[model samples]
Target: MSLAERPDLMTTDPVTWDGGMGSVGDYIALLKPRVMSLVIFTAFVGMMLAPGSIHPVLAAVALLCIAIGAGASGALNMWYDADIDRVMSRTAKRPIPAGKITPSEALAFGMTLSVGSVVLLGLLVNWFAGAFLAFTIFFYAVVYTMWLKRSTPQNIVIGGAAGAFPPMIGWAAVTGGVSLESFILFLIIFMWTPPHFWALALFKSGDYRAAGIPMLPVVAGEDATRTQILLYSLVLVPIAVSPWFLGFAGVTYGIASAVLGAGFLGLALQVYRLRTGEAARKAAVRLFSYSILYLFLLFALLLGESLVTRMI
Candidate 1:
């Protein structure tokens, strides 16, 4: 429903829509900066791994546009999810939910950034990359947040595409197209997302349940979520290791991927086995934490190897 149509959301009570100035930090908070950081890192790795080099200035611009697009997606998500964000403990402090920023303000901020980023990227970089970035924003803000997240347990499973597109977009920014190597990068993150999020869902099932989010654990039960985590981890490891086998990465990355993949599976196994009490929660938290590091290290390794190869 439109903000114009929802009286409760349009109140000038400061907590809802005061039409007052929010601090700069409140505006930044609407962007979900942590998630934007991951999007930036992965997209940079994709750029570095692409076959051709871009002018460093253009590359930086591309990354900036990507970061803005990601931030826009986050703001829109926060705006739309505000109602439920108020209920969930984890998100209750978000700018909109915490009364730091109004929903109308956030919507305007997101829409402006979303349009500006795509247009600038298209004009300054490449249209292909611009188009992909636009789709990523739409997928996250509309497809995942507006639809899947509220309606199905497979939310993360399908919505993961939004997060997984950055590398491909980055690759397109440099090469003006996609390739097998880029898709491998995409696939690695895509497969990793389910296990990563389901682990968080395992521990935060209560929060999801309270918020009516329909996360896998909240909808399917913990045992089923654990099983899915393990199953996805099994697929993720091989895909994470694939760039090495596919000739894009060197032996160092291969060894590191194998080691990292082992650690991932080990944590996932613990999450799967410890299904009750504090032990289970701890296991889930561990898996969730490690999953972040796992993806970062994988991309960091790929970026490092590509840079070294270029120098040699």
Candidate 2:
């Protein structure tokens, strides 16, 4: 049985500083910068696509607050999950588990940024955006990390709403309200997250199982997880393509979405079919990697069209 399955053997020692304070890099690593970058990009796309305009300075500030809020959520997650982090090979070297930063310090850092970001965004921009940003942080840090992550196989499904809110917050930053167009953007990410994360969980099932993460693959088995990945992918593609048909996007976006979406579906299908051995692992890895590119390109196309339309 996995260490996680043998809970009696699991260590609960208090995590403390090793010898000295962490370096700047170690501190930043606590923020999960890779994830933060994605949040910033997605939020920026939402801000850009909003119908109305925001002052350039306010727009930059909104993005900054959103980024900081996202980083804060990451830090909090690392803090709370440090116990599991130490057990999972993939996460073993995270700042907290590596003893580069104390859990209390990480918690303080995260909370400070979380409150500060929401307050600054509200005061400097619109409260609607600020409120949504606050909720996003709370959802990721509290709802997802603290609650759902360890407790349910449906964790990623329910927790994805947190990530989906960034675009809506960006839209509210400009228009001070959400419309169906903005919600569609939100829906695209929400639907895409399950398959994307599940693909990662497939190859990393061992890591998740060892850490007791209860990822779908760990709880439901690989075949079940693969089936769910394909189902989510099928639903995700059309929702991803909808912004184009809904008239918010143009033909260029429509064509790009359709083509990119075909590639996404093709990979998802491959993951579904390749059911065992190294081929299965490779397929899951490909889908995981492609999902990142697919989402980026889909949003990039929309951003490009928005900019070109503005220019013309």
Which candidate number maximizes TM-score? Answer: 1
lDDT by residue (1-312, candidate 2, tens digit) is: 988899667868766545457788987898789988888888889999998799999999999999999999999999999999999988999988888888988999999999999999999998989899989998999899999999999999999999888888989999999999989999999999999999999999989988888999888999999899989989999998899889999999898898999999999999999999999999999999999999999999989999999999
| lDDT (10s digit) by residue, model 1, range 72-187 | 99999999999999998898988888887889999999999999999999999999999999999999999999999999999998999999999999999999999999999999
lDDT of each: 0.94, 0.92
TM-score of candidate 2 versus the correct structure, residues matched by position = 0.93
Error of 2 at 59 (Å): 0.4
Clashing pairs in 1: none
- Model 2: residues >4 Å from true position, as ranges? 1-20
Name the weakest run of 10 consecutive residues (lDDT summed) in model 2. Answer: 11-20
Candidate 2: RMSD to truth: 7.0
